[model samples]
Target: MTLFEAERVEKVFPGVRALDGVNLSLEPGSVHALLGENGAGKSTLIKVITGLYRPDGGRLLLDGQQVSFGSPHESASAGIGVVHQERNLIPGFTVGENILLQQLPTSRGLVDRTAIRSEAARWLAELDLELDPDLPVTELSVAQAQLVEIAKALSIESRVLLLDEPTASITPSEAERLFRVVGKLKDQGCAVLFVSHKLEEVFEICDTVTVLRDGASVLEGGPLSDLTRDEVVDLMVGRVHEALVLPPRTVDTTAEPLLELSGLSTATGHDGVDLAVRPGEIVGLYGLVGAGRSELAKALLGLDRITAGEVRVRGAAVRIRNVRDALKNHKIGYVSENRKEEGVFLEQSVGRNIAVTVWDRLRAGIGRLPVLRYVPKRAEADLVSDYVEHLGIRIASPAQLAGTLSGGNQQKVSLAKWLAAQTEILIIDEPTVGIDVRTKDAFHTLIWDLAANGLAILLITSDLPEMITLADRVVVMRDHRVRGEVVNSRDYDTMSQRVIRLIHAEPAPAA
Candidate 1:
């Protein structure tokens, strides 16, 4: 029997049919995986189920009984809980308080702190988690906070738990712990709805699978015994393009290194990292989550402090104390991993967002009009228009708000932000993350195009295929150190094995 069901669910927003006639079902005590790219309506479906948004037309049933959830609170009371990708914990509060927030055990008119701690401890112990109930949430690591969120969800005694990309930020060991937790939850007859971009994890943990594409259910029901990864990838992408998208490497191969780091060490994950990239070269950094990939990029770009070693741009030793210094002197640009928070101003117009990085070139002074007084800079505006057209950004005009664009187009705008900055060295962290197959190709094309024009790029990503396809050389990082470097040769198996070893094998200490 179905534990939950949504039939012909529809959600309309302006010109978008966010969800159209989407149908789904969940069975008790089974794990269901929701599969989709960034803007595939999976998020909308989750919101509808959790009562964050009301569907325009649909029938929702819980345990064969017709039901409507007016609020998230109502959904929670009905044993539905969601652990958002972004942890919603209050840092100042203790773990116990965060777990049972607003519902602490209390007498008629008195608080009961002891009982709350005891209960929180019990919840943690259930998952074999070692956490101090009285410890402040702020002190917890990303992995620890994730465990606390899970314990909090289980505390609700939820019948259905929605985990959206729970493993995105955590390490492999932490992910194993979560998988074990999911197993335990299953043993207790709780239904789990898992959403992840990691296909391997989904196949390993989920008993049933549902694939949603463009706000509709395309495929459902999978033990996945006979499916290959390539088959799944094909289904996800739908069609292949015949375009020779990525431009060939055009920068003089004999040129000196554009950016070089020698024994660069930071207090964070980047410890004594050393690397270099020549002009018009794309060097790909690949590793698992927490492999110090993005951290290294940030340090070289001066977004993060480096406690030791030297960073140089074109053989010149530079003191890049902040982002502004990096941009002004080194012409360094960064596309952050967390796009929503660090990449773009979602509410701002496309033109304004693109113009932000190149404001110095556009303005006559720091706060004055352009050289052509009382006249709009038609040439600069035309550059923005050309970029939008080149990237195929789907918007009515440059005046359209960045937030209103699709996930792909928003990514394009983020790229535009940096491209317009006219930076020589570009640091892109997870450029194709959360983007669809079509969009991924477009992004791949854009990155190579930039490199073809003499841009030195440090491409930091977890996606191995992307690294292999786009990089001239691949650098492997493990245990916060550079493991080895290899030239790209379109060899999947050999490359995969080497990457795995780099991630799992112990590294020798630096001399």
Candidate 2:
């Protein structure tokens, strides 16, 4: 039975028609995957469904009865719940309080903490999670926080759940657990809508798929077996995708290794691993969620603890215990995978954000010597402007707030910050995620130019095409270890297949 349906949904923003005549339908007990490129109208549709935006012209039906939602609370009360891509939990609040917020049990008009804690604990226990109900939300890891987000939505007894990029930051084991929970939800007759750019997860869990492109429905189908992955790619971009050309390898460069990790490991997420990158080479690290890709990157950048290994730069081992150490010693730059969290200060002006990274370069005699705090100057603004122009970032002016730019443009800003630093080894994680096709192409071309300038790059991504296109060699990781290595040659496609197999292959028994 059809649980919910939208007809002729249309939404328009300045300079962009976010959605046009987009239709969506979900049935009870079904898991529907919504697939689209970034800016392809997936978020817009979700916003419309959850009352974040009103459709200019459309009809929404619940159980064949037309319904209207005026606000998120109204949608929630009507059995709709959304787990936003960005976890919106308040840091100071306890998990239990966040779960039962605004509707806590009351005793004589006083809040009932005992009841709320007990209820929240019970729900969390169902997921086999060990989070303390009384602990502040800030105490949780990203994965734990994600679980709490789901628990909060589940606490509402919602009939329809919308999960946006749910597994983007989760561990592999956690993602499996989430899949089980989604299955359980379906078994209980709940309609679950999953929106993600990860196609592997979509195929693993979704019952049906709805593809949207350029704010219109391009295809609707059940059982995605009929569509090849390339077909889906073509549909999203409206053209045959051409693979990126990586420059040929040269072994004679005496430029030395810009960055080196000798059995570097983060105690929290990844174990001991070794990596090295040379100037003018792009090293691809490919893995599924929780395979330690991002964690390893963090360790190299000093955002995470090294725990038990040494990081070397220019043939000398350096102790970088923090971001400042990494920055000053190695002159490294990082574009994080979770761009919304660690990428940019959205409320700040683009000029400020870009100039902030290279303030020292433009400052006169340091106001504070050791501390390295300096005010921005005209030279800093000019440097930022050069980067903005080079990256082809689409914004009215550098004075605009970073938050107002589109996802792709925001990504460009994130990359521009690193370029301004003039770092030797640039580490980027999932750089093109949540970006459209045209913007993705532009971003790739810019990165290619950066590599051509003799910058060693470590690119971490789940996008297979990107790995094949951008990397001179690909390293496949599984179960927290490197499984196989592939050298990109004329046989790059065949080698990429081996890399994929290595990524998904089961681990062998420890010797």
Q: Return the top candidate by TM-score.
A: 1
- CA lDDT of every candidate: 0.79, 0.79
- The per-prediction tally of clashing pairs is 0, 0
Cα deviation of 343, candidate 2, in Å: 0.6
Q: Compute the lDDT of residue 153 as modeled in candidate 2.
A: 82
Q: Please give, for residues 1-511, the per-residue lDDT of candidate 1 as tens digits.
A: 9888888999987768888988888889899988776667877888899898999998789899988999878898998988875567987899999898736789776768899899999889876778889999976645567778888887888898998777765555667878998898888888899987777888899888777777877776665556665555555556433444454565566888988988888877566778889998999887765567877776776667788989889998887877777887779988877666577898888888887877666655434644544314675678789888888877768877887665567878888878888889999887775565567777898888888888999998767777888988888887678888877776888776666666777464466
Query: Whole-model lDDT, candidate 2?
Result: 0.79
Model 1 C-alpha lDDT versus the unseen true structure: 0.79
lDDT, candidate 2, 1-511, per-residue tens: 8999989899987667878998888988989988877667887888888898999988899989998888888889889988877677988899999988746888999989899889999779766777889999876655567788888888888899999877765645567788898899999999999987667787788888888888898987555677766776677778766755545545334657788777666776556677778888889998765577877777776666767878888789887777666666678888887667788889998998887777766667555575665555678778877988888776667787887566677888888887888787889888876565556777788777788888889998767777777887788887677777777663657765677678778454367
Q: In model 2, where do residues sit more than 4 Å from their true spots? A: 56-59, 100-135, 171-173, 219-227, 243-247, 250-255, 261-276, 281-311, 316-329, 359-400, 432-452, 459-511
Q: What local lDDT score does residue 483 receive in model 1, on the 0 to 100 scale?
A: 82
Q: Rate residue 295 of model 1 by lDDT.
A: 70
Regions more than 4 Å wrong, model 1? 85-157, 170-176, 220-254, 269-271, 287-291, 364-381, 395-400, 404-408, 474-479, 483-490, 504-511
Cα-based TM-score, every candidate = 0.81, 0.76
